[model samples]
Target chain A: MFSQRKFYTPYTSPTDPCPPIEVKSYETPPQLYLGFQPPCLPQYASAKEALHRGTLWPALYSPYESPYKRGDTGE
Target chain B: MWYYEKKLQYPVRVRECNPRLAKFLIEQYGGADGELAAALRYLNQRYSIPDKVIGLLTDIGTEEFAHLEMIATMVYKLTKDATPEQMKEAGLGAHYVNHDNALFYENASGTPWTASYIQAKGDPIADIYEDIAAEEKARATYQWIINMSDDPELNDGLKYLREREVVHSQRFREAAEILKEERGKKVFF
Candidate 1:
């Protein structure tokens, strides 16, 4: 007969807890870089406000004016 | 949901008709690392891409179709009205024997286009990285094509195509960063 798969059982309290691995990242991209900004949801009144609130994800924090916006209206 | 652009993203006005060069350039049209492959890969991947980045995928993928059309125009212009003797001398007689000056689906070296040239992994990170790589490869191909000829008309279009690849790579990079944040994955950019 083929071996039947057994369901995973809950861990007993006798085992040591798994240690967390900390990754330090200096290569993390910023909200704005080299005259370009990654796409961001315009939730914050300003990117300064988002940074003040400690929002770190780059895509969620755009700071540049989009060149694609229509200029005929002169915004 | 799409509107046709009456003009090419860049004009493929090849001043000289060179079947030999056309044979090489055709790879960018239908080869493994060609515009058609780029268009199909991104378009197919968009359905599985996160909703926020779907707009990026669709826009870039649609632009790839324009590049595809440009390549086709170049190939067609190069081969149209080419004499049978010219075709044979240019080592395209084998292609002419089969296609008779028509645009058949084949790479620069006459390999038939195949769907296996691309991937639709349905993973946003993986697919976007693949997209980025595709743009780089396409850009390199355009550069190699440019190096082979001094035709101003062809060079202008090829340079524009190469520049678009750089812009597309940047967009894909932005899209990947967005998807990473959306999915809460932490990795260096």
Candidate 2:
């Protein structure tokens, strides 16, 4: 499975006052991987789950976890 | 004619009062790429759009209004019991002076919303592209909001709103494809 999250490193100056973040992460929406939505794609087992996730199709669901949280980036 | 639904499309829950977060949430409420701009843009553009995609416009545009209501509920809950000092510290002093605790159509910086935020060229390709871009922008805004928010319950609602943007963008892309396929086809009675 392709990751919806993407990452990058920014140039850090040695003289900078604050510590530079080694890696910065951003998200890519699922639609970028899809050209057009196909018919009869697999759906969530329950409509309530779909409503909670904000998407009925599992393929289109891209979860966003806050990068600020410890270990949220899977580091 | 549209029928009024008494409930929000999605339930909004605010775990606590945080005027600062409310200030940030106002961006989606009335910012350039906010829900209000999105709703009006599609609703107005539908009249000039092609027959096949007009219903899509109507549906998504109407949904944006529901999203707007959700945001309004959040803002109301966040600021309802907040003191003026808290509002000032939250960078909403200007807003407090003008609207008090009532919600106003303004961005986080208190800039009032304007129609200039949206455009309709009357071209199906052009307009649909705009809609897709708008959804992506709103999605990004929601993500940033989640990043700034400390309220887990609020993040739940924000996440849902952000995901809706993804779905809406895909639907618009599919609409574009449908329009493209009809480019040179002729219908005979």
Q: Could you say which candidate leads in TM-score? A: 2
TM-score, chain A only, candidate 1, equals 0.19
Per DockQ, the best of the predicted structures is: 2
List the candidate 2 regions with Cα displacement exceeding 4 Å: A70-75, B186-189
The sequence of per-residue lDDT tens digits that candidate 1 reaches over residues B62-83 is: 9889988988898889889899
TM-score of 1: 0.69
Best by lDDT: 2
Report the lDDT of model 2 for residue B176.
Answer: 86
* Inter-residue clash pairs, candidate 1: B27-B108
Candidate 2 local lDDT, B1-189, one digit each (tens): 699999988899999999999999999999999999999999999999889899999999999999999999999999999999999998888888889999998888888999999999998999999999999999999988998998999999999999999999989999889889955799889
Candidate 1, superposed: residue stretches over 4 Å from native? A1-75, B182-189
